[model samples]
Target: MMQFCYDDLDQWCHHCVHFVFVDEGLIAFSSFVLHLCAIKA
Candidate 1:
């Protein structure tokens, strides 16, 4: 039971990290697109 709990916690942590990484990538892409638009304008 303890091992199962630890595994669950590890999986949750991995998911959280993956989400944050994806979120950061999206924000960076958005900023890059805006920068391009500003330059075009």
Candidate 2:
């Protein structure tokens, strides 16, 4: 997983319109998608 700066997360949240910080650390959507793709492959 990648580490994002606060500003990067802020920008994403602004553009995403609906975002929440979950305690489980499952917030990195792009990485999560890539991980899933890798798993499928």
Candidate 3:
């Protein structure tokens, strides 16, 4: 039972890390797009 709990916690942490990585990528992409628009204007 304890092992199962630990496995679940590990999965959760992996998902949290993945989410943060994707979120950061999105923020960077949006900022880059905005920068391009600024340059065009």
Candidate 4:
């Protein structure tokens, strides 16, 4: 489950940066996921 979420995040980050003009929020979101998963672990 954890690895799946991280993989999804990686794909989403690339897609988000590629498609969206606003990356700051996406980057922040990714970081949030990192912290979230770390805490979960």
Best by lDDT: 4
Against the hidden reference, what TM-scores do the models get? 0.39, 0.33, 0.39, 0.39
Local error of candidate 2 at residue 14 (angstroms): 26
lDDT of 2: 0.43
Predicted candidate 1 versus true structure: per-residue lDDT over 11-39, tens digit per residue: 33433223323566566654554454456
Clashes per candidate, residues 3 or more apart or on different chains = 0, 0, 0, 0
Q: 1 or 4: which has the higher lDDT?
A: 4
Model 3 lDDT on a 0 to 1 scale? 0.44
Alpha carbon lDDT of residue 8, candidate 4? 63
lDDT for model 4, on a 0 to 1 scale? 0.50
lDDT for 40 (candidate 3): 56
lDDT of 4 by residue, 1-41 (tens): 23443466554444433332346657666676656555655
lDDT scores for all predictions? Answer: 0.44, 0.43, 0.44, 0.50
TM-score, candidate number 2:
0.33
Clashing pairs in 4: none
lDDT tens per residue, model 3, 1-41: 22442355343343322332356656665455445445655
